[model samples]
Target: MILHIDMDAFYASIEQRDHPEYRGKPVIVGGGNGRGVVSAASYEAREYGVHSAMPGRRAGQLCPHGIFVKGRHSHYAAVGRQVREIFSRYTPLVQPLSLDEAFLDVSGTLRLFGDAETIGRRIKAEIAEELELPASVGVAPRKFIAKIASDIDKPNGFVVVREDEIHSFLDPLPVERVWGVGKVGARRLHQLGFRTIADIRRYDESLLKSKLGAWGAHLWRLANGIDEREVIPDRNAKQISHERTFSEDQSDFEFLHSVVCFLCEQTAMRLRRHGRKAKSVGLKYRREDFRTFSKSKVLETPTDETAVIIRVATELLATMRQTEPRPVRLIGVSLSALVGADAPTQMSLFDDPGYVQAERRVDRVMDQLADRLGDSRIYRAGSHDWRKRPRE
Candidate 1:
């Protein structure tokens, strides 16, 4: 069976776990700025309509007494590593969806671990006991149902769906319960008198296809509890990126440019950490009105160089700013189309032959420093003014 594990309000939970006084209080983790968005909120905060991705300004209005905290990505990454280690002890076939959620294929380990339900319960208890973190576990014969089952109870939930009971468990649920059926899909399904999965299952395949296009058949089958997907052991990352939201809208080009340089360096360093390089660089920005857009440029060669990524990102930012010259609330940089860091470098006549080697040596030293003192402790020359000042 496939077991899906989701850590409850992971970032907020971590904050509460680390700080005993924060427990049972409405706690939030994110940018800690008026313009910032909530990355995660504790269950207490959720009762007041505060949630992840909500505006920090709104979160405060909803839960005025809530404790807001800045996210410590380095600390969270360390805890995530520990969580992965716990999963490894149970099964090698584990796929991490994020720092807080994963899928474990226990089909082969039943003899060693008992039934799927037993394994799921044991994992939930183990994570809670060993790490002092609550986890929800969902077990099913297929990946999709298991994922859905995990969130049903939530905050230290364990749900098991045997093969024959899949339909009963899913039929009465809303179409939105299906993973791929988002707001748009759910609206369309509702329009078709398909409020429930059971209602969706009653539709003819041809009619579903005619109404919903290519995804119709897939949705219909999923509604009827037919998911033929396997639990893959790895969640491959396609891009590396970083962004920061400001406490106030920023229209100044020079200051935003400096932020872009810092974001580029951070992303490039992360790419190098994975022994990867990116062939394309992109920029994203959100206006105070919340409208966001992005643009990208393909490079002639893959690179993990901060200067190259920043240059491309700055060019893209200029293009975006020209189209929408509003005060920006947030800015981000991303690198995609990745290759190995050791991918062949095509030397150009304009380049000094020793330059690439020199950059690598510098990166090696920086990596060591970052490993010992965290990424925020070090910065490039261009990424100044940010260390001491908050986004506002």
Candidate 2:
């Protein structure tokens, strides 16, 4: 069986745990700054609709009395490590989805650790007793269903779905519970009269495919509990991204474009360090009111060059701005569909070989300078000191 373990309000809960006075009160980590974005919200804060990735200003508006604490990313990472250590005691087949969530396949460990439910209960008890953190666990025969079962009830929840009980358990739930069915997809599903998983299950898969394409067929199978994905241990990084939240909302396109350029450089640097080249570039834009938009483009050829990444990301940013034209709370750049930098790839017929060689030489020199003088001391001229620019 598979067990999905998700920590409850991880960052905010850590703050509350350490600061006894914060208990039972609204706590918003990465809040209090007008330009910042919330990293996590405690259960108390969540009552007012505060959540991770929300603008700090908006979180304050929702929970006026919320306790705002700056995030300690390194410390949280340490805590996450401790949690993983606990998971390691029970099963080596643990696959981490994030610091706060993981999947463990215990089909082989049943002889030593009891059934999946018992092992899950034990793990939850250990986290509470040792770390004073709450977790929700879901036990199922499949991965996606296990994830859904874990989230059905949260903030100290546990649910198990037997092989025989899968359909009855999944039928009544909204289609949104299926992975990849985000707000836009949910709306499309609703438009097609798919309100529940059962609705998707009853509909013809080919018809669903006709409406939603390949994704529709995928969702249809998930609705019928046919996920074939295994709990892969130590999954490689599938994406790399960096983002910056301003001290205040920003509306200046020139300034925003510069920030995107800087972020793209940072992302590209990391991509090169990982010995990978990206086949896709993406932009993440969060508005002052907290609405977020994302756009991405697949490259004609994979690249780890900052120039190519910045150009694509900037184009996407321009596209997003044309539609929204609003003050941005946060902006980010991401690289994905990564392949080894040394991997065989199709060379562009129109490639300027001299330009490519020169760009690589510049990148190598810049990387060396960054290593010796620190990233803060070295930056491309086009990406000015936007972080130090006074908020408007």
How far does residue 161 in candidate 2 sit from its true spot (Å)?
Answer: 0.6
| Residue 135 accuracy (lDDT) in model 2 | 96
Off by over 4 Å in 1: 31-35, 235-340, 347-392
TM-score of every candidate: 0.70, 0.69
Q: Candidate 2 lDDT, tens digit per residue, 1-392?
A: 99999999998999999999999999998747665667789999999999987877888888899999977766787799999999999988888876799999998889998999999999999999999999999999999999999999997999999999999999999999997665556766788798999999999999978766666788899999999998877435678888886656789998999999889888898888768988999998776544568899998878998878888898998899999898987788989898889866565888788887888888898877665443545678768756444332
Per-residue lDDT of candidate 1, residues 133-238 (tens digit) = 9899899988889999999998888888998998899998999999866554566678788898888888898898887665788888888888887666532457
Report, for every candidate in turn, its global Cα lDDT versus the true structure: 0.82, 0.85
CA RMSD per model (angstroms): 7.0, 7.8
lDDT of 2 at 141: 98
Q: Which runs of model 2 end up more than 4 angstroms from their true locations?
A: 235-392
